[model samples]
Target chain A: NAGVTQTPKFRILKIGQSMTLQCAQDMNHNYMYWYRQDPGMGLKLIYYSVGAGITDKGEVPNGYNVSRSTTEDFPLRLELAAPSQTSVYFCASSYSGARGSSGNTIYFGEGSWLTVV
Target chain B: AQRVTQPEKLLSVFKGAPVELKCNYSYSGSPELFWYVQYSRQRLQLLLRHISRESIKGFTADLNKGETSFHLKKPFAQEEDSAMYYCALSGRGGDDKIIFGKGTRLHILP
Candidate 1:
């Protein structure tokens, strides 16, 4: 089974442009997250969803919007891309319903590289 | 505020040498720590967790509550071990968010 899948492995956007980064997981996980990694910086959470129809803002959610319409999908939208938005984005998922041990391990996708000019 | 710290930005060692990646964390309550690794052209994946205390790929991490540290160690490093390693921490109970460190790039030369 494909654990997690992300589309548009690479993309280039002009300033003020908008685009969506799609994320899908086949594991039926309850928790999904979007994170962006800049040079020499750790991953910063952009947005997250506990389950379908529920989404929340994360540490670096500015200029980004997220929606969780289905169990398998949670997409992140960049309203107006800026040079600062250029970075690598990753999507992750974890099963929260399970007991303590299994719930904390997060699985990440290959990542999407976005370049804003 | 909860945070994770990895002081070393880069670490290099010769193949077959011992390796250690240090991680320190700050949190009010009990925390769950984890080590994640990313190899070239590969997705970031969980290497180990403090809760599990299990070793994978000859790599192991120990959580020292007294020191507020969770350091990853391997007796013998291999060329394949070269990658970026991150230390992460999540609080107990209802806290689902995970805080990650800047990460350390480990390079094992032959």
Candidate 2:
């Protein structure tokens, strides 16, 4: 299985430009999340969805948007990109039906590198 | 508010030496803790979680609720043990949103 897959592993955009980071998972996980990792800082949640058709803002969701159109796909949208938005983006998913009971490990995708100039 | 902290930004140790990656968290209620590791040029993966109470890749982490810490430790550090490690925390029964620490980069010398 492909597990978690992300597209356009590397991208560069001008300031104020917009783009979408596509993510898909075959594990059929109910919880999906988008996170950004800076140089020294760890992953910061941008947005998340429990399942298809439901989404919520995360700790650092100011400049991004997300949609859970299907159980396998959850894409992140960057509007008016800024230098501050340049970072490695990771998409993750997990089966949460048995949360706090089982391993419930979160599987992450091979991150996408985004640079804003 | 829930927060995770890894005080060290970088740590270097020689091969066959003991290794410890410090991690601490703050949460009022019982929170699920996890250790995620990212090797050079590789995607991040789960090393272990407190609930599972299992050791992975010769690494083990124990949750100390009294100190709010879940430090990762290994007896004999190996060259392959070098990587970036992150400590994460999640609430008990919500959407399972996790908060990650700043992460520690462990480098093993030959």
Candidate 3:
């Protein structure tokens, strides 16, 4: 079902440039999230949405923005790329919150490696 | 002010030996705990959650509210178990925000 898909598996952006990381899930999930993975810092939540047309900031959301126009898509936008943003980004989704047993488990994308030079 | 800590960055265990990956969390209220594993060049996936109280791939973790720990353990380690393991936590109820630990790379040596 392509669980979760991310575009541009790898990308390099010039300093001060802007780019968007596209993420889509075919499982019809209601909750979607964007996370950045560094070498020693596990995964920091950038932004997340509970449903379509609803978005909220996460742990590390200062340099990024997000929009969830639909239930299947949650795109992360980097307005001004910086060298500090150079890391692996992952998109994930879950059917709901921590209510159920199995359905709430999150599914992740293959991850996009971004290098800001 | 919620945080998940995985004290070890890397752990090596001989084949058929017992294995344990320590995890401790800090949260004021009840929290949901999870263990995620990422294989080489693969997406991160859920290995187990504390709510389910079930074991997956021979791995089990018991939530200790008193100690605020949810450590993953396996009776016998296998080479196939080599992967990066992350401990995660989330607030109770509708809060889907899950924070993850730095992760521990488990190396099963033969």
Output the lDDT of residue B69, model 3. 99
- Whole-model lDDT per candidate: 0.90, 0.90, 0.90
Model 1 docking tier (incorrect/acceptable/medium/high): medium
Cα error, residue B84 of model 3, in Å, equals: 1.1
The chain B TM-scores of all candidates, as shown, are 0.97, 0.97, 0.97
User: Candidate 1 chain A: worst 10 consecutive residues by lDDT?
Assistant: A95-104
* Candidate 3 displacement at residue A103 in angstroms: 4.1
Give candidate 2 misplaced runs (Cα > 4 Å).
A99-102
Colliding residue pairs in candidate 3? none
In candidate 1 chain B, what residue range of length 10 has the lowest lDDT sum?
B90-99
Q: What is the lDDT of candidate 1?
A: 0.90
Query: What C-alpha lDDT, on a 0 to 100 scale, does residue B22 get in candidate 1?
Result: 97
Model 1 steric clash total = 0
Candidate order by decreasing lDDT: 3, 2, 1
Q: RMSD, each candidate, Å?
A: 1.9, 1.9, 2.1
| TM-score against truth, every candidate | 0.91, 0.91, 0.89
